[model samples]
Target: MSATDKKQKQAVIAGAGPAGLTGAYELLKHTDIHPVVFEESGEIGGISRTVRYHGNRMDIGGHRFFSKSQRVTDWWDEIMPLQGAPSLDDKLLHTTDKTFAANGPDPEQCDRVMLVRNRISRIFYLHKFFDYPISLKWQTFANMGLVRTIEAGCGYLWSVFFKKPETSLENFYINRFGKPLYRMFFEDYTEKVWGVHPSKLGADWGAQRVKGLSIFAILKDMLKKSFSKKENIKEVETSLIEQFVYPKLGPGQLWETVADEVRQRGGEVITETPVKEIHVENNRVTSVTVENAQGERREVPCDYLLSSLPLKDLVQSIRGIEVPDEVKRIAGDLPYRDFITVGLLMKRLTIDNQTRIKTFANRIPDTWIYIQERDVRIGRLQVFNNWSPYLVKNYENTVWIGLEYFCTEGDAFWQMDDRAFIDMAVGELAKIGIIDPADVLDSVRIKVKKAYPSYFGSYYELDRVKEFLNGIENLWCIGRNGQHRYNNMDHSMMTAMVAVDHIAAGNTDKSAVWSVNTEEEYHESK
Candidate 1:
């Protein structure tokens, strides 16, 4: 289809997130659609926003800009240049006295994103740092000890020779790493993240995330790294990626820029507008009723509608249509994992060695440390300064860390008052030997609902829901929660790209958009 021919249709997008924004950008650039985007939150990025708190900016959860898709990488580079810029000598730079000034350097004005080379992330369990993805190293041996290491090796060999059928998340992990390794490295952390036992969770989530990786592959890759000269092997799985790009301020900068470019191209981007009612007629979405922050309702009519709202919410909110009772029940039952990020600002501190006390300058260099310790409720800890110099208000001796807690909305932890929650988080940090409670200068807590789509027992019902939604000719669901498919940031954007292509070509192929990350092989070469 010609670009000019695509100009006649008006596209209305729900949620100005990565997928919705990418869809709008694609439509505005290739076609003259001039799409209108509506974001329910006050910010542009949905869960991906870089929230500001007391002169500091931090992501809700660490969002690394790594993807195995070249198209997605190119799109990111087009939006925010990740190269051809002078590097900032972060080591030489010191925190200035004006760090806490109200008027700080604005990331939007600079329009910059730092392409961080490679950062270390280790599992902190049993007072030992184990390399993530289970690398063959002395520290791993020292942590597991000789007997446990031998047991792990035998377990892997047994699983390789006698494989079991995969049925649940437990089976998925055990099928790859054997029951021993799965119980040691995955059991507690996985349960903490999902709030469900692995045996009850569906295997689809595991396949989408950690598939194409096994004990054999890890051993083979380790041997090759020690002996071979060839590099950049294509078979390496996504979980084993060592390096990734990140925005200077945070991921919000990228989506915020996309919103600005869309406006510059004569497109409308509205925030704090949530679609409350979807009107369907003749098996097509005709219009939607939205409510603003001021409690004003307005009807937005459009020829084509792209939505990034949760599939359950979208299915339940449609009016003037008769959705199947079974579909509604299944969709509504789809679980979600909420998130809370507690940013703790601490004064200059030091950890004492046996001989003498030393500064925390380079003591812990991990961007984020996975909490494999089961006692604490905190699942992970992100060192904000480690992610980027711009993230922390002061880069010198001061420190900023984000404690991530995974919970369901309205649960005991989620419903805890901010002050109480802050206290609990600080106490936990002290308990975990991360920091002293007295050293904390200030704290801020941010709660995000439906941050992760949980793959529960009802996840298989999503196929039926997708089949039903596919019958609607004018509506397309795209994004992580939009499709309930635990897609990475790149996979989410790729879905929008394909959705735009389908809309422009006047083709009805929801399957094409849905099939993006379902394949077993890497879609892009290094």
Candidate 2:
């Protein structure tokens, strides 16, 4: 790489997300190429951003900083060092909420960078809590009586003896967890979340989501844990990890620090800039046109482009790029799941005749609970206070909880008023016996469009679109939506890492980025 090459090299990245920001930071570290990041929203993190209201902060979707890949872990540590990470006992565990914030009066005591926390979660179905990994506890057996347990065991044996062809999501779960457990735990909840029956939805989602875990494997692991007192036992599954690392303020703190570091290293991070058009010549992306907050558009020339935008939006923006008709069709047809998080503030939550006693801002032990009951449309709920003490305005009396609903952009839930949505969340919470209506204080609603790149009808057509994009050597799709992948935080960052490596090594192998998280044994979190 000569001076001429360095002078001409400028990588313009679309979307200042984990992937895009990671690519920019890596480019600055490894090469002399000037990288510029453009974010469509006022915030930095995509779905990972922490929404702050008053003095409280909430993770858009609860994120745990645990990755199987060491490279991803190292990358996270580089931005937010966990060497001297804070522990529960380090500095006053049961302290009041008056002691924390990003910019508090006493900054030293309220450092908002690195912290490790415990994780406990379960499925709430039929007003009963079941261990996520389906442990063989006596309480579990009692909840699901002896007869039901025998039925489930028999179903498992039958499935093993006569394996059915796995075609739809229903068959996929049945093959792994058996029919009885699948119907009891997965079937209806999945249908409610995706707005489609398991028999109608594609099995690809199940394949990617629960790749390595099976009923037998979970039982074996639980038995081993229950019997052994060994400290050396490692959690091979992310979902089963007892603890994880996190930013004190929330996940967004890590990315915000990354953005600042990128700027310090002579890189530009422009927020409120939406990509309007991508200009291509001779099958190579030459420039990108983006509109700023005031609706003023400008073109930025590029030697290479890394996009973290949704695949559909990315293709539609390629008007001047002359994309192949087949690729365009596939991109247009790609489906996505939008999300809404209703952040509710409450005085206290009492369940089962016991007030939720607080310890370090946690009212309950579980960080989040999967709502598997058929009655509520809310798929999951997050105990924001458990995630981080800094997330709540007051830890003693006030707590924040996030009721998450998965829906399409134009759907009824999405279009519902904030007041109605809050009321609905309260109604569901009351219906499930999780919280009391009178404890509610105030609420905030955050809607995210295309939050999940859905694995649904015609999702397989994305393979053709990916193939077409790979042919455009200068353009690389390198994130969750960028590749239409349901990648975890680490996997998303890994795609960007691989993409930047390709440019650094002077290779044209875009497949290296596309091949991420495609393994049958690869589950994003689990």
Candidate 3:
């Protein structure tokens, strides 16, 4: 094969998640590169897709848009065009001057997404239903005696104050919130989500989410806010410490716009084209094998390959491959729980305290009802209407509840018929008093396998999987499943940006791409 037989220059992105699409678009925008993207789902959005239930639209779960990086915001704002996107004639947000009591705001950060969209969210005191954070203020009265709370409190203070570092999520939180609060707020829900005890789970994910949150931070904030509450105190900005940007529609609208922009920019986005195999030769990823919904397979060759598909699934799909047994074993050991959403549309003209669902707080039905109450291994339920008002259908009004269940491909929950699954969620949720069967108008179910990547103390194993991909030239892995890291959506997209930059430089390092999960640098336009 001479120059005449050489393939036209292009890149292939497997999966339409934020990372894959971002990589494709960044390559097109920043380099003289072209790309073809293959997505397994006919729908563009992955975990962020919007689905309809009884004529009402909802996200996979309750997804919120809150990124500090301007690069992310630039891409998002440009595509979603948040400055003047579509909107409901009657804006859905209700402002509470009492909740957003900050003396002043940066005006700039608070100006873009929310201001133009006319969406608003702030705090609300719910019948004094629960404590602010799992704190000693109430743990002493809840069930544990003063002696116990005092002992745990002392341990927590010593743990953090003495710089006695904790290496796991259980130890980190156990040392901060004390065992009771950790048990109450996080333990049950996480166990339901990961299908494992909190102790077994690594603290890295915990720290990234609520790291540096000490017993002191909670206690100090509680005291200060308590005093300030009588006086009223609130902070509003676009900073991480302030307001979070939200779409008028569900979060999927962001990806939808991004997909449109990619198409308009001459990039090919082929949804429903599941990649079947990655054909390799002499340690190079020569081409990709893909199958459609009807199961016709074809190989597409490209200059580079940026994959956001699952690490294990990608590994298993290699043809004429010669990977080491240890790497294969590591990939096999990587375990993750897939999730399905039972979205229940309700007949309410308005759900009570609708805006209070913004925070991941307890009470107010916005709270995740840990399914530990029943034999069901279901995870938490997200009220989709809580994400944005554009989700509701009409003045008819609605509440879109996402009941999540952890499942393997053919397990009990996974095998359930749609009707059976919805019935089960309704029954279990009603038992918890979070919802009533009578209020439900209609329902729809979406099963997304391998949504949340589980971190099961397998970083070294993940590295082995990484090694296998590293051996394949012109291939980079990005996103949660691609690297098997529990990175948030923003972190995953950032990884894609870095990968595309390297592609522009004619370099392909799988390891370098995986390491882009935490950097905060903005992608300055050249």
lDDT of each: 0.80, 0.80, 0.64
- Cα lDDT tens digits for candidate 3, 283-329: 77778988988889888987788888888888888877787787777
Instruction: Choose 1 or 3, whichever is better by TM-score.
Output: 1
What digit string (tens of lDDT, one per residue) describes model 2 on residues 343-443?
A: 98988776531224345444566678899888789899898867876677665567789999999999899899989888998999999898899989888
| TM-score of each candidate structure, all chains considered together | 0.92, 0.93, 0.80
The candidate that wins on lDDT is: 1
**Candidate 1 lDDT tens digits, 188-304:** 998988998999888887887888777767777777778866656365566676677888888887888899999998888999999899999998988899999999999988888
CA error at residue 90 for candidate 2, angstroms: 6.7
Using lDDT as the yardstick, the better of models 1 and 2 is 1
RMSD of 1: 3.7
